[model samples]
Target chain A: MAPRNKYSVILPTYNERKNLPIIVWLLNDSFTKNGFEYEIIIVDDASPDNTAEIARQLQTAFPNRIILKQRSGKLGLGTAYVHGLQFATGNFVIIMDADFSHHPKFIPDMIRVQSTKDYDIVTGTRYSGKHGGVYGWDLKRKLVSKGANIFADTVLRPGVSDLTGSFRLYKKDVLEKVITKVQSKGYVFQMELMVLAKAMGYSVAEVPISFVDRVYGESKLGSSEIAEYATGVLSLWMRV
Target chain B: MTRAQQTVSIGLLFASTQLYLALFLQLIPLPSIISEEIIPVLPLWALVSFGSYLLAKLGYGVLTFNDVPEAHAELMKEIDLAREDLRTKGVEVD
Candidate 1:
């Protein structure tokens, strides 16, 4: 028999009190329905809204299924993943947004794709396949996203359709290896991970997913973040 | 090699080949029109075509970008169900 696989979802959050409960509930529903052995690791970086407290309440409700790792200050996303990784015991690790932008329903598809050839990483994409696309974004938002993706594809040529999408399932070993090589901190982090994984000769597969923008919190993509993303892509082009 | 190195190497090779072709055209007495008119502005033409292609691709992508209202509506219902289930399970939800 194939070895039983466990998936640990590392959800990094800040001030996501309102969305946390619903996302957790949906995750539980998805996992239960799929009959997958999984655990959720909530790595909360001290949100004033008491997101961690809600996570603690969730731990009570879900018992061993929920693992809450609270950090002191509002750290960056990369560090949050690193912190969450330390607590993940599953053979496969999933990294996704806690804001409900990346739904849990697609996790099953990602797993199925990963199993076909045992891809080292299975990433959810919004730009390829029939079911792939985004909702709740305006024309300008779509333009920016498409432009960023084209720019990255031109420069880095990572071969994956969606470079910025954060919904992904990585074999624990591949994720650990790739994360150690990743140096970018913010918006560039996801792109950098994909590029570095390709550089390290890891097999990657894509699954189509509908990315619904945040339901509760504000989704911020400021000019400064765009500038940062541009520079980040250029730097990866030079180094990777 | 890194992507940067590969790109640079390929670009340099292409530029040199174009330069050699242009020089050969000038030396070999081909039609003056072909040599002077087309060869000189070939890179510019390539650039313009590539730029247009990228623009059209981006435009088509933006035009066809899906807006799934049904997903949004379904999620709202899911949220209500989740909230009710959480409350029933003795979990306090705000």
Candidate 2:
């Protein structure tokens, strides 16, 4: 049997100063209720809003579980995780958002599904089940998201419903291999990871999850991100 | 895309229009109401195309270049300058 070790949560945050405490509390409650030993590694990209300072305060509160790895600047979303993964001690890693878009309650389910399937990775899918849906985004925002996923599906054919979704659980070794192969670091970074995983013959499964919009601060996604997505999509399309 | 990008694209379209006009202006010699009355905007289309091509190159350069190192170096220089100023004022920084 494979080793069942501590779970490390690598959360990449930027200007999520408001949601830090609540997200930490929610993770603590979820992990405590599930009786799992875990670590929350806050990977901040030197947010101007003092997100790293808040992470330090959270470290003082949780001591052992919460850790801070402040980056020099906003390099990219994908690189932030790569930076955090270097210091992650657990055999399994959970990567998610700090903006409350990814609820902590779904984590236990993701772990359970992975265990049943003996999967190397388990990602949350918003379009898989009846209950899973995005809340608090306008119709135009929803269309752009759906179109991106659809465009990816039509091209990459990664066999995953939600390639653009960031919330995922990965075996440390599997993540290590996948990250090494993923080159795109823009909006389609998540999509590239899954596509690369499939190319490498990794076992991946998805658990249904309901995604909620951010509760505080502004969303990082803008028109520029959409254009980046287009570039990333075409780049992958040509590669595959 | 910014205002410059839009202007370049419009200019490119105008360039193709001018090439068309330069070709059509010599043939048929249509009535004044059909061809001669229109604003003579097509001749500048070649310039528009050149401008658009340059703009496209600029856009590509912006996308492909990474400014992190330059930015980091700039920040370091500013920090050094500030440290010098502080030292002159007898301000200690740890």
Q: Which structure among the candidates has the greatest DockQ?
A: 1
lDDT of 2 at A95: 89
For candidate 2, write residues A1-240 as lDDT tens digits: 755568999988887766676677678868989988899988888899888876776666666998889889987788988999999999899989887777787899988998897799999987756546666666566666766776677667788988899899999999998898788886678888888888788999998877776645567778889899989988987875
Model 2 alpha-carbon miss at residue A19, Å:
1.2
lDDT of 1 by residue, A13-69 (tens): 888888899899999999989999999999888999999888888988888999998
Native contact fraction, candidates in order: 0.64, 0.00
- Report the TM-score of candidate 2, chain B only: 0.32
Docking class of 2: incorrect
Native-referenced DockQ of model 2: 0.02
C-alpha lDDT of residue B18 in model 2: 75
* CAPRI docking class of candidate 1: medium
Against the true structure, what is each candidate's TM-score? Answer: 0.94, 0.69
Best by TM-score: 1
| DockQ of each model vs. true complex | 0.64, 0.02
